[model samples]
Target: MTELGFTLKVFRQIGMMKPILPHKMLGAGLQLVKWGPGFPSGVNAAAKRFPRQLAIIDDAGELTWSEFAAQINQLTQALKDRGIEAGDSVALLCRNHRYMLIAMIAIMQAGGRVLLLNTMASRSQLGELAKRENASLVIVDQEFLEVAGDVDQDKVILAWADDDAPAGLPSVAAISADQPTKGHSKPARNGQVVIFTSGTTGLPKGARREEPADLKPLVSFFGAIPYRGNATIVLAAPLFHSWGLINFGFGLSLAPTYVLRRRFEPTRVIKDIEEQKADALVVVPLMMQRMVDADPEVIKKADVSSLKITASSGSALAGELANHYMDTFTDSVYNFYGATETGWVTIASPTDLREAPGTAGVPPFRTTVRILDAEGKEVPRGETGVIHVGNDMPFGGYTDGNTKAFSDGLMSTGDLGHFDENGRLFVSGRDDDMIISGGENVFPRELEDALIDHPDVADVVVTGIDDDKFGQVLAAYVVVKDGKSLTEDDIKTYAKEHVARFAVPGKTMFLDELPRNPTGKVMKRELPEFE
Candidate 1:
């Protein structure tokens, strides 16, 4: 039987068959009855239907669906034997690997919460997170074992490198051999996963699931996407981020083949795509830029025709870069717009990129978006204001009692944008970054985009500086192209020709590079102040 057919059969046996709902009911009316067989049913169906199909590929090895499911069962039994129970939080710290995927499934399947840890995070950060979440168990790869320093070794489960198990640790391979199938397959309560969000304040806030109902719409929406049977998906982003989790869940729900990379390496990424024949990749803006900037000979040598979809998120994709990607691949390059608190709000297709250039496209199936003024009233279509979203998306309020993020049932994204006449979203800049110069609002993104068009400028960040006459003055930090020399007058001249006089940056500072987060988002907070 086909994978879809097998899934439907299992759903029927588990009495999970239900009518699919339209995307319009996503926020207000969608509900998921406990009629379906749940997560295990979908996984088991994939195993039965495509037992030999490759499910996961990493540096260690590739695991077929059957092997993957069997490993999950074994891990679940092992954890259970170790005194773990349902609803316990399992803190996981590891790079992208086959073991991590199996452990995540095993934990959730056993009715435990999976608390993802950022691999790049400091030891203090991880320890604080573990303590804050009250994790019952911790798992770490040998590389990250140092981060767990003095954190109760007894509570940690380390994956053995060789066949020999570490002292007090169960043999992962041996456990799989003992019982290929051992745990009950039941879906946990909705909102079982607690993802922590970075707070504006010092402490990070943990966002828990609201209701099982919220997941139904997402699950259904994912099913409708063009995921092929047992297709390989390249996972390059950090698993701790929301986009990373979304990609992981997408693969899990569809039971697709996945290729895991420990951390993004430009050369390795090119090699893996060709070697694994990966069909899809989920990347951020910086990763894509690096790949594009890699050696042309290496890019030409790599076989990228097998790739069908390239999805980007976490930061904005410049229109020039987007156009170049489409021209190079001749395939769909999707730009997803949303936040950690909110799931996908809108998706910009390659077609949209070609037509509208910078638009974030229409809202996702059931999402409602409104551009609101400071008073929370809707603004005109062409007027820019704060962007508010209302949907079935689940968000845990801030840990520091900052409920002000949400206003009138809509989540405040802290972003400034406006909807075109056709309802396309144009995210101009962050509200905090808006420069109030001489009583006029100047969005840096407009000026930044104009500056980027200059031949000498490789990258540029525009910000507001204190001014005596004006409330705030505009400043530009620019990274010039290698082997190219540019002066402040040249930059100013170029900006004046390309952008409005008020929008032109008043002061320009040349910099070797700008600070960026792991996800490729510019760290505006880290920018140095200039006189």
Candidate 2:
């Protein structure tokens, strides 16, 4: 078939599949085309449609669509007052609240790049990141002022300060109070958003992305996850991460009511879902685990049936955990598998999880997932290989000039995974995290999964430790369930029953919890050095 013929056929299939799509999706595309692609353009369109409807609910309270748009404009004007210009980098170091949300949109509206900074980063890490990114302005939450010591004093703005200001630094509220309610002039080019990798193995790197012209990817994403336009959403994931930011972007265009909190406290989160009657909850796997482990009565009281979808990403979801969440929430969980570099590769829908338990669902429309061996040849089904992906979201490459290896125009996801006969993907582990012990390639994830299956185990992380006899040996850090006890031998026995003897952890250590980054990835570097 001709290329044009194939493209037409693809669109025909999409129209047939999603005949009743939300009208706002079409409006979103038109708005982008008319006003040029940027966060401000989407917000302006939403304001026009739902002027009086609630757009955001955070710790600072709620704002209607019109109010939300006005704040964004005021913030943009304030940024202009401070000499922020197009293409300039503005680093945002606030938590999940109105301040961060406003800054993200305002920076783009004021013709500046939005550089999202992790709230969990230490002083040194924040300093290094700011310097590396060449951030022209650093807007920080007041609580994190200590970490902003290295940032240029003249270029600092404080937000979300409950206490009296630290003398000269301007607060976000102060800046937006006196500025114009209308948005600033259109920028020469649309500003981009840059998010940092979780940095499990090393220092974090930035993944930059520009505003998307085509809304087809977003529309296709809704088909996979079933998030309706204008649906109420509770964002539990940190906005600095890709997963949360993606949801926020959808909320902007779809004009959803966002229930935001500064932190992911299990009880409060459940209450918010129940009180807000939120239709969707965005979270990482660890946050879900915490919710599932909360007090039983509290969980029962929470009317989470309001939630139609619980979108999870940022890390692999253990099959056991997925099953538990689905059983609790009546199969409302949707596990999304992807990375910062590659937008979204696949989404494990409720039906897919019910049928296959752990399988990451088939690739969404226009996404391509390939599992290839070291030779760059496709591996047979059910055999693990390096996972590569191609999609509509164009990767802006790393700011440091480092790039993921690519073959045939598909970028490497840096993960090892295999597809089942049904074409559902299962991630095995990171390609670099594979341990060559006694000449056998053993992935830590396999051992971790085995340990997690134990009835007494609540959480587990497996790492390869140095060994004189074997090139390296497996060390397991185990977190037992509450009011439960398990010995090192018991864990070893459980592992022996589940996996090969060599793959069993050679050393076991008990811990109350595993150290994890903000995105819930196990911080392997922070683990204790085994004796």
Which one is best on TM-score?
Answer: 2
Model 1 off-target regions past 4 Å?
1-42, 159-180, 185-191, 198-201, 209-216, 219-225, 398-404
Query: Each model's TM-score, in the order given?
Result: 0.84, 0.92
Each model's lDDT: 0.70, 0.82
Provide the lowest-lDDT 10-residue window in model 2.
12-21
Residue 499 deviation, candidate 1, in Å? 2.4
**How far is 433's C-alpha from truth in model 2 (Å)?**
1.7
Which pairs of residues clash in candidate 1, taking residues 3 or more apart in a chain or in different chains?
A: 16-36, 191-209
Per candidate, the number of residue pairs that clash is 2, 0
